[model samples]
Target: MTETQRKVGFLICLITIVLAVLDLQIVSAATVPIVRDLDPDHGVDKIPWLVSAFALASAAMLPLYGKLCDTLGAKRVFTGAIATFLLGSALCGAAQSMEQLIAARAVQGLGGGGLMSVTMVVIAHLKGPDEEGTGKGGSAGGLVAGAGMAVGPWIGGLLADHASWRWIFYVNLPIGLAVLAASAFVLKLPDHPVRRPLDYLGAALGAAFSSALLLVTDWGGNRYAWSSPVVVGLIVTAAAALALFLWRQTRAAEPILPLSLFRVRELRLGFVIQAIVGAAMMCAIYYVLVYLQIARGVASSSAGLYLLPMAIGMSTAGLLSGRLTARGWSARTFTLSGTATTALAFGLLALTTGPATSLWLIRAALLLMGLGLGQLMGQLILLVQFAAPRHQLGVATTGIRFFQTLGGALGASVFGSVLARLYAADGPGGDVSALARLTGTAHAEGVRAFVSATDVVFWSGAALMTLATVLAVRLPRPGRPEDTEQPARQPEPVPA
Candidate 1:
């Protein structure tokens, strides 16, 4: 690829990130209409699954996607992934039942998961040349990549507001076509085909553990009450599956998630930090939506709009942190500082009374939290990649994301439940009639409950973030977010 084409290829991938990451938050704004259309009888309480299920799928499938990326070429896998995403989006638009919607979402999640992780690996491969303008350690490349992803929620909101919420998913169609076209002509990726075989056993075990664990978590409190037979059975089954997964991964020749990567202190610590960070962030967005639309009577579009500050705050923080890391600051500094800042931010947020409570205060709180989270992903990603042998970067990168995926799923589910619990008694005299008339009828009680419960959940998220800060301090700085050491041998084989 010529210089111009490389730039264009890079731009195409940026568009891919926008389409992919938007899957996570797109439902945040669209769930209202989705629930009305899919399960009018269930109301808002049960509708979170519409949003949370996709998150769970994307989270659960991240490693699956990563492992496949290693086995498959990035271009092949990327094209396939986007195709699946577009198919899922169309299916979601036509979904007629809750079951159908959930299944369609899983399909989207499968592709979304691939899009999330491969973009990084692909950028690494595409930007291998250290041309004069490519910048240090591909930092410019990484920055473009990360920044493209960070803006997903904001773009998602914009689409949901101006177009129908369904357009959020639909928009990916044209973009995916454009990416495919660009890749065919512009993107020049070095093929690194390794001799390692795909570890199907490992994939199956990982799937068992991830899917079952999340299923139990999602169904435990809501589907069957805590002690229901179904819940108990799921929990017991998940424990057994996870145990088997651990045992098999130890012996697999090419494990989907080689546990050996954790031997590196920085890598292991980074993985833990990623999980904690995911949990904290997952909860923050979940509760903030609650506070804005439910507790305070803000419009749906306005609620999505409020989160714009958070995206901006994180963008600024992400860029600054990358620059700071380049200047020789340690990961420990940014990670720990971010966590501390997040704690302060969330603590302040927990004190806010309502959406109208104070715009500046909310902005400040989100700003701090975003700043902390901004540098998080790219920084630790470098650590994990650095710790791995080149040939193993595929599995290793996926492994880090697996931990993050699991944490995010658990975080979102637990937080949603917490929000529900916090507002169980929210209605006036336990009567939702007026609220039913006031809010969307089918969603009246649930919406009110989530709103009333937002404060408590936000406080809980705040506490979780505080814990993340402590974990962040334990890892040594990996140096720069972009300056990762190459594996002794490259992970992708050189093209002939």
Candidate 2:
């Protein structure tokens, strides 16, 4: 591919990723409007499913998409995924009931799963074997995706308030169509479909495990007690399904996820670090929003506006780090430094949690946190890509994303449970929005109680990031001459 062609293709891929990630957060601000319009009577309980369904479906299909990319070629799979997403978007926008909306979201997520995984694989191919780090292209892609996440809620709120909540889904049509048109014309990768058996059984088991596990996290403390029979049953089912999946991988002709990838030290470490970072990042993003809306009594749109500082910090740092790494700076150094910086930022946030705390102070801490997160985001994938065998690139890339998604789900569940418990103990019986209406002394006490809960959350985040720092310290430095030149070896076939 020519330089110009590569640039165009990369941009198209980046746009797709941004859209996929944006859809995840955009609905948050629109939830209230959606409920009011759709199933107001029972919508509050069902609204969570709209988000949960998408997440669960996306996470479950990740491995399948990875394998599909390898078997059917990235172009075909990617284009199909985009079309499927567009279809889902149309359905979501036109849905008449909560159940219809949730089902549409699941369809949307199926396509979204491919959008992230296949694009990374395509980018890896574009970078070729000689590129040592996540090049400028990959870093730029990450930056755009992060920005989408940051702005999604603001956009959603704007639409919900001034226009219609349906616009949130409808908005994707034009952008997605353009992406498809551009990719069809600009992407020039050769497509040679492999005639091999896919691991159907393994894929089924993997999906089952992922879905069950996500359910356990999403429903554990929110809808049911942690020790409730349904939660415990889901946990057991997830464990059993995962065990069966792993055992089946050893016997399959073409396992959807190659277990051997875990044997690579760099890949293993990269997964671990990605999981920790994902958990910490999710917790920070979520609770910060909670603090803004519930404690500070800000509108959803304004809360999103406050997130801009962190988003800018992330984009700037990601671009700079990618450039430096490409120029031969050690990725390990950036990872370690970023991890430590994020931990420090979290500590600062814990200290500055009171309602009377300066908004500027909170913004500064969030900026630091985003900076730290950006440094690690693209670099970790670069490490994993560089270490993985060429044949397994799709699986390896998706594996990182898979673990990260799982971590995010787990973090949200655990942290939400903690906040609920603390809030109940401090001052019982009020919905999140109702707490914002407290007056005088009551308001002061409510804010204090919210701050106390946030303090614990941030402290926990700091500890997680500190652990990530230790793992980053163990990561091998980039720019090894031999490592860059090593040819892509044919990966071993799955056991028959």
Candidate 3:
């Protein structure tokens, strides 16, 4: 591919990633309008399904998408995924009822699964011979994602309030169509000559496990009690499916997620660190918003604006890290520094929690948190890609994303339960929103209690990030004697 073609391919892939991120963040802001227009009477009850359906279906398709990328080639898989996503988006825009819309979201998610993961594969392929793939494209992708996160909900709110709710989905069509067309013309992906039989049975089992585990996390202790039959049954199902999937992986001709990849220390550490960063991100974003909305009495839309500083921090770090990596800074150096920065941010957040704590202080901590995390996502994937065998690039890239998504789900569930328990022990029992409705003294007490609970949550996040820092210390530094094993294992080093 020529220079102009590479740039175009990169642009198309980034737009596709924006589509994926926007869809995830966009829906929440439009829900109230959707409920009113679709089924005001019964829609409220089914609202959770909107998020759940997309999340479950998307998670379920990830492993399969990775395999498809390697076999069919990234360009073919990329165009197909975009076409599927556009089809689903059209269906979503035209849906007349809540049920239909939810179903359409599930369809959209099937394609959405690849929008980010496979795009990373494509980006890695875009690198020219002699160009450093030290995460330049991945860092740019991260910056785009952070911008999308910062602006997505605000854009959704703007559209839903001023235009039709359907336009939210409709808006994706033009942009997505353009991306799809450009990719087909511009992306000249390397061909994979060696074809192997796909493990359909293993894929099915893996999908089943991912779906069940996501459901267990989403529904547990919120929609159903932890001990309820529904949650218990899902737990058993997830366990059985996971066990069977692992067994199948060991025996399959081409496993969906090969166990052999984990034997590489860099790949293993990269995966674990990616997961920890994902979970910590949930703590930073979700709990901060909760605190703002419930305790500080900030409106939801305005509360979202608070994330801008963090987003800026993320974008800046991504850009800066790309330059630093080019200057001989190893992935290990960034990992250690990033993890330590995030841990300190969390520790500061935990110590400063109070009903009257300044909002600016929290914002500062968030900015620090983002700076810390920004260095990890792209660089870690670069590390894993460098460590993994060339044949396994697709699975390895997607595997990082898979672990992160699971980590987010599990962390959200666990932290949510902890917050609930801690609050119930001190505050008047019920939703944290109740704190918003309380009057003077009671409201003051509620704020204090909520602050107290979030303090613990931040501390927990701090502890987790600290643990990641310790693990990062073990990562092999670039150009060092310890790093020789990784390059020795990947003799080809995955072509630029």
Winning candidate number (lDDT): 3
lDDT of 2 by residue, 1-496 (tens): 8889888888888889988988998999999999999988999999889898889889989888878877777788889989988998999999999999999999999898888878887787777446746455667766676677777788889989999999999999999999999998888875644467889899899999999989998999778888999999999999999999999989997799988877776788789888888888788888998898787777767888888888888898899998887887766777788899889999999998787889899899989988987887777777787788867777888899888988888888888888878877895345344576778887778778878988999999999999989887776555443433343345545536
In model 1, where do residues sit more than 4 Å from their true spots? Answer: 35-49, 94-100, 129-165, 193-195, 326-332, 354-356, 416-459, 477-496
Residue 67 of model 3, lDDT score: 87
Q: In candidate 2, residue 119 scores what lDDT?
A: 85
Q: Is candidate 1 or candidate 2 better by TM-score?
A: 2
Best candidate (score: TM-score):
3
lDDT of 1 by residue, 82-134 (tens): 88888898888777787887788888887887776776666655654342112
**Candidate 1 backbone collisions, by pair:** 192-492, 192-493, 295-451, 331-477, 390-491
In Å, residue 93's CA in model 1 sits off its true spot by 3.5
- What's the C-alpha lDDT at position 157 in model 2? 90
Local error of candidate 2 at residue 131 (angstroms): 3.3
Q: Per-prediction TM-score, please?
A: 0.82, 0.94, 0.96
Residue range 1-496, candidate 3, lDDT tens digits: 9899999888887888899988977888889999999999999999989888888888888898888888879888888888888888999999999999999999999888889889988988898755544766877787677667666777888889899889989999999988977887888997877677999999999999989998998899999999999999999999999999999999998899999888777888888988898889888888888888887878987887888888888888888987777666777888898899999999988977677788889889889888887887678877777677877888998999889889988889989999988988899746565776788888888888899999999999999999999999988766665654445234433434
Shift in Å, residue 362, candidate 1: 1.5
